[model samples]
Target: MHELKISIITVCYNAESTIERCIQSVINQYYSNIEYIIIDGGSSDATTGIIDRYKGQIQRVVSEPDKGMYDAMNKGIAMATGQVVGMLNADDVFTDNSVAGTIAAAFAENGNDILYADLNYLKPNGNVLRKWRSGQYRTGMFNKGWMPPHPTFYCKRSLYDRFGIYSLDFGTAADYELMLRFIHVKKASVFYLARVVVNMNTGGVSNNSYLGRIKVLFLDLKAMYKHDVQLPPIALLYKRLSKIRQFF
Candidate 1:
């Protein structure tokens, strides 16, 4: 195994209730070469205090204000010093202790700069609510509105140097935009690690309310137009309807 140093970033704001669980998951990773960084959005809650409990395990922690989640992620990316970088939300976690090991092995097997996999949506009681299985990436998949879950997405630091990081202007669609730009436009080499990798909690900001969803749709349309990703009106309807299958 290539013992690649992997940096996992957890961006949070006022996540006192779940930040510790997220931190524990990272600290207990079976892999040895792990760098954990936490970026706080000047949370008024006890989030930073909770993070302080694991200061020894965490390599770095930056607590300050930011424009939004994507901006906070940008800061974390700038601080990353590992060959591979991935994000673990404050409310989500690796599916197992060897998750990092599995990721390292996949990157070692092929010269794939980008790696992503399936994810499980968890209920508050720790039960699986839904499964997001991201199949292999094929050419032109983005046009059909296919996107890998951001929490399970990992890529070499060099790709960011070559392309770029999350765009603040894209808002909730920033993750979608970045993936489209990388996989479809720039044609970065990628691999799909066909297994559940992270357990993402529900109630993410973008899906919290009807208004949020509407905003996401507008931003997504903007991104698709800018990248020249053809999203036919019928295809857009199918895209929204397809998510229903992820649920039970």
Candidate 2:
């Protein structure tokens, strides 16, 4: 079996507390051909120092100012040399050491352009707050508020090379925009892993404040229009309402 190299990117800014866990998760992956990259958005804290301590394990590190999260992610993606690439936020970690191995096997077996799994959101005390289960992909799922967890979304490097990277214009919805562009518009081949792949700490930018949620909604609408998804208004409604299930 040809072991395909997988690059996992972690983007951070002032995330000193949880960055170590993220780094360890990537380092502990069972898959041998893993390249871990970190992109820091000029954090004026101990985040850079913490990352430095793990420099021996990480393949590449970039500490600089960027437009926002999406911009930082674009930088990491650009630097990645792996056949498959994925992102893990500074406040997130892979579910287990086998994640990388499982992903590699899935890619080898299915040869899909993209592979996405489930994810869990945990409180500060490590209690499960929300469980986001991405079942499978369908023709019109995007319109029904179906989106794979961004942290669990892994795609071949060529997909980004062809469909493009995350756009900064969409604000917190950049990931959503990129997924919509690739899956709904470009019609990329995708496979579902049907397993929880990552654990995200609660209180991310999109859900931290009401204002942030509003901004995300506006940007999501813009993304739907930009990608020419039919019935955007209904899709936006479905997107907002679909989150109700995650809490249960």
Candidate 3:
């Protein structure tokens, strides 16, 4: 697995409080040969300072203005130079040091183009609120509203080289679009490791408000439509209700 280089990118903007833990999680991984890249969206806070503190550990650090969260992610994707590339938001982190090592071994064992796993959603105070069970990847599941949490998702660089970068058009659902385009539309081989890969803090951009939730459903419908998947509004409704079941 060491032969395959994995590049993990973290996109940050005013994430000073959590960036340190995020960086340390990657740097302290048991698996060697990870290309860690950090893209900062011109943070006015101490984000840059925290990044500089661990500059020696990261392969590359870019602090510049970007369009939005998705745009910053695209910039990092362009800079990635590893066999497989993945993103972990500044506020989120892997479940453990060996998560990356586990992912690498899955790819080496299966030779799949994409890999992902389950994730735990935690509160800002570090309380576990829910477990997002990303059931194994299966073609046509997008119509059923089955998606791997974008943070826990990892894909080969070639997949992006062929399908293009995350589309800024979808806004919060851009990661959803890219995953669908690559895995469902392009039919890329995907492997789902049945384990928790990341621990993401619950209050992210998509769940920040009522309107945000509506926007996610709208864009998700558009993404499904573009690929000829044809998901009805009820599917989104069912998916939402099914997700709520995880909180219990």
Model 3 bad stretches (over 4 Å): none
lDDT of each: 0.90, 0.92, 0.88
Question: After best superposition, candidate 1 residue 27: deviation in angstroms?
Answer: 0.6
Q: What TM-score, to 2 decimals, does candidate 1 have?
A: 0.97
In terms of lDDT, the poorest run of 10 residues in model 3 is 230-239
Q: Which pairs clash in the backbone of model 3?
A: none
**lDDT at 196 for candidate 1?**
96
How should the candidates be ordered by lDDT, best one leading? Answer: 2, 1, 3
Deviating ranges (above 4 Å) for candidate 2: none
Top-lDDT structure, candidate number: 2
Residue lDDT tens for model 1, 1-248: 54799999999999999999999999998899999999999999999999999999999999999999999999999999999999999999888998999998899888798999999998888888988988988998778878899999999988888999998889998998898888889999999999998999999989999999999888888888888877545445666776888995
Candidate 3 C-alpha lDDT tens digits along 155-201: 99988888899899999989888988988889999998899888898
User: Alpha carbon lDDT of residue 74, candidate 1?
Assistant: 90
- Candidate 2 per-residue lDDT, tens place, 27-78, comes to 9888899999999999999999999998999999999999989999999999
The full ranking of all candidates by TM-score, starting with the best, is 2, 1, 3
What is candidate 2's CA lDDT for residue 59?
A: 97
